[model samples]
Target: MKRHLLLTAICIITITLLNGQAQAQNLRAFMQNSGFLSLQTDTPYAETYLSVPGNSIVYKTGANGKYEGALEVTLLYLKDSNTVAAFDKYILRSPEIDDTSNITFNMLDIRRVSLPDGVYNVQMQVLDINSTDKEPLTLSQGLNMHFHRDSIDFSNIELIDSYAPTTTKNVFSKNGYDIKPYVFNYYPTSVNKISFYNEIYNLSKMVGDEDVIINYSVKHVQKDAVASNLFRFSKQKAAAVNIVFSEFDITDLPSGNYLLHIDVRNRKNVQLGEQNVFFQRSNKNSVGELSNISLLDVNHTFVTEIDPDSMVYFVKSLSPTAEMYEREYISTILQKNDPKLMQQFFYNFWQKRNPTEPEKEWAYYKRMVSYAAYNYKTAIDYGFETDRGRVYLQYGPPNHIDGSDREPGAYPYEIWQYYKLSNNQSNIHFVFCNADLVTNDYALIHSDALGELNDPRWRFKIYNTFKDGNGYRNFDIDYFRSTWGSQVDQYYGK
Candidate 1:
């Protein structure tokens, strides 16, 4: 029986997979800007999301003369490069792609798969399931699988999307745990809290009747000896494949590499077992400490514009420019109750960027602020406070936008397209949804924006399945496949 590897981790990378070399190197389909989520294998059941490029698969005109593709995917948990254990599956797809300019333009076909635990070199091959005249396309890559076969072990740490007690047995529910997994490792400033899942095992073997104190801490790992504590908590629980699910507020922690450090100990405080799972944070508010850098005002000419109410809107307006100043620095400045310094710093901020015409620059941005307020503001929230408003202020107007209204049975959503939001990203699209059914306060649900919310399962979010506690609809995957006329693949143009 196949266990669904349904752990969703958002990972983004640029690919021009028009050739065999590009096709041979990767199997990921819609990963955005995060690392692949790791899954532990020792459990009786496990699941994850995997993908293959549609173009990589060989296709042909059927007996009916319609183009079709078939793929066979297999994973061999490796003992070295040699296979130790294996799982395999076959898939047939009808890609109704009209863009014939590039034969590989149908886009990647993502699928779910299951496997037994071992280190794996994932291998995949594709063929036209109907026509057998052409050679099949093949690719392979190594993956680390710590299927926690240890006597005293833990499951792979799962970043939680959401979880409630199981009321229904579905894709998101397992072993009395109804949990959804996030698609990315990098958490930005907007993500204030982090929730995750891990399972403890063989505690009955390590200890007898007495309960043990289990501790878990999120430590910001540094190159130096000092690793600051971001969050710490402990609990007492019995031994077994014990489910350990916890959430921590990482909003205050500086952006960097961090590890969730876990330790199991006895009543004497002696450690029984320990493990760590590493994750990266890209919160601009948490990026780096920039409190000391002074913008030397050769001419403090604009000092007259400084005042107490500047706190009311100046930094609030400059929230889009979070890359320059740390959140703590700004918060610290605001808390100090010093109006003059804040104004001086604010004036220097505009002057440094546009020395000759600082007023012109500030005025133009303020117009964007006003525009955001007019378009995205709610009864209580300013435009800049809303997701669409913040995105408007930060990235300016999108060059193109698609899907202005809700689908027949889907949530109200808009797809904003940017020609080039950053040096590394081109033609990125963000999917914003009015999940609350509000008119002007659409939240940024998912995007391919380089450093934005790059949820891989956007279709799930767009369809509101996540609200009902399911990762997807009954046949949403099949629905997405049937609807891609020609416009869908345009979002991923090279």
Candidate 2:
């Protein structure tokens, strides 16, 4: 039997996930949930590994079957909150589209950096080198590292996508280790094997002349059956410094979620240290056993006590999601007229989001929804019905908002500046102008956010108005960009 801990895949989300990342740059940063890897070899320091999301870069076709895209990644190892210690910049370009359609480049851009032992606030920026107007995508992470001089220790487990016996040396291979990193924790059906590498230091201090017992296993999530908990493999480490690099064929493991578990024990079989990372295996060859393991859905055992109509309204008030899958779900449920079932679905949705406290989560969001309704209500619509209200509810309030109502011949307009939006974009502005001119219904006319209105001529639309004996007329202007303001403070009101 293997001594192990039952890791609820749910608990892994307690800490700040990709949501804790910095705001978006030109490229929407797509990082694996656990993309950082720190490993120490032959020194008292470690090299950090991070995988930047690929495929998000705008790819264009070039002549003769080539795909053109350029990315510049800058890593700043901050000494403190405001001080920078070291930096690394990598410029990557793919001149050819080896596989254009496999756009989900899960393990696309890999970055490795060497630094001395200390905690660092890692500020990373990914920029589309092709565009001069696009903002550089930026994200920050805290990098904490410690190396003991006289104690047994292990480096973070590094996942390798594939490996082969090497006869020569290259950037991807070191000391005969020809390996490609498995950036994300996802292993599709095409990925046949899983390999990992890690370094152990000063192990002789713990075991003396005896060997260090290493247990390597992959356990199914939350399953306590004997087969799911049995031992996978165990090895003896007979050296002070060990580079444990090996691969295992996972073709037979049924398609499901698993943890590649590693445990280091002393000679007495007492667990000394352990570390593991989450991974999802998609083994299509497996029988129908894993069919039910669809997208992670909580047990549909809970129900909402709210009335059906109120529940529908609550769902409607929820932005982004309400406009997306949540809306479709409610529409389908209107046919069944089963409030209990609807409640279950609603309960499960939030439960999946904040499993520890779904009620608290709902309460907080409900408060925001109520606030939105109160502030954005108009003659024919509720607060949540307005465009500004939807954006406020969906992306939350802007960091700083500026407005101008008395500009000559200009519509009452406002610019909402968000310092950051959900690990996506930062310094983004939403320009809302009073399109109706009746009540306070300022509509979103243009924005610089990806997929949002990016009209360079927004200035003309906002200011190209003249009161010609009637209301106003659509017209033009001269050097509005220059007369408006400087580049940094681009707000219209002087």
Pick the TM-score winner. Answer: 2
Please identify model 1 stretches exceeding 4 Å from their true place: 1-300, 465-494
Clashing pairs in 2: 24-424, 24-425, 25-136, 25-137
Model 2: weakest 10-residue lDDT segment is 4-13
Error of 1 at 444 (Å): 0.9
lDDT of 1 by residue, 15-127 (tens): 34342222222233322111121335433333443444555444444556455555554333333334444455556464744332355443333333444444444444444
What is the TM-score (0 to 1) of candidate 2?
A: 0.48
- RMSD per model, one decimal: 20.2, 14.8
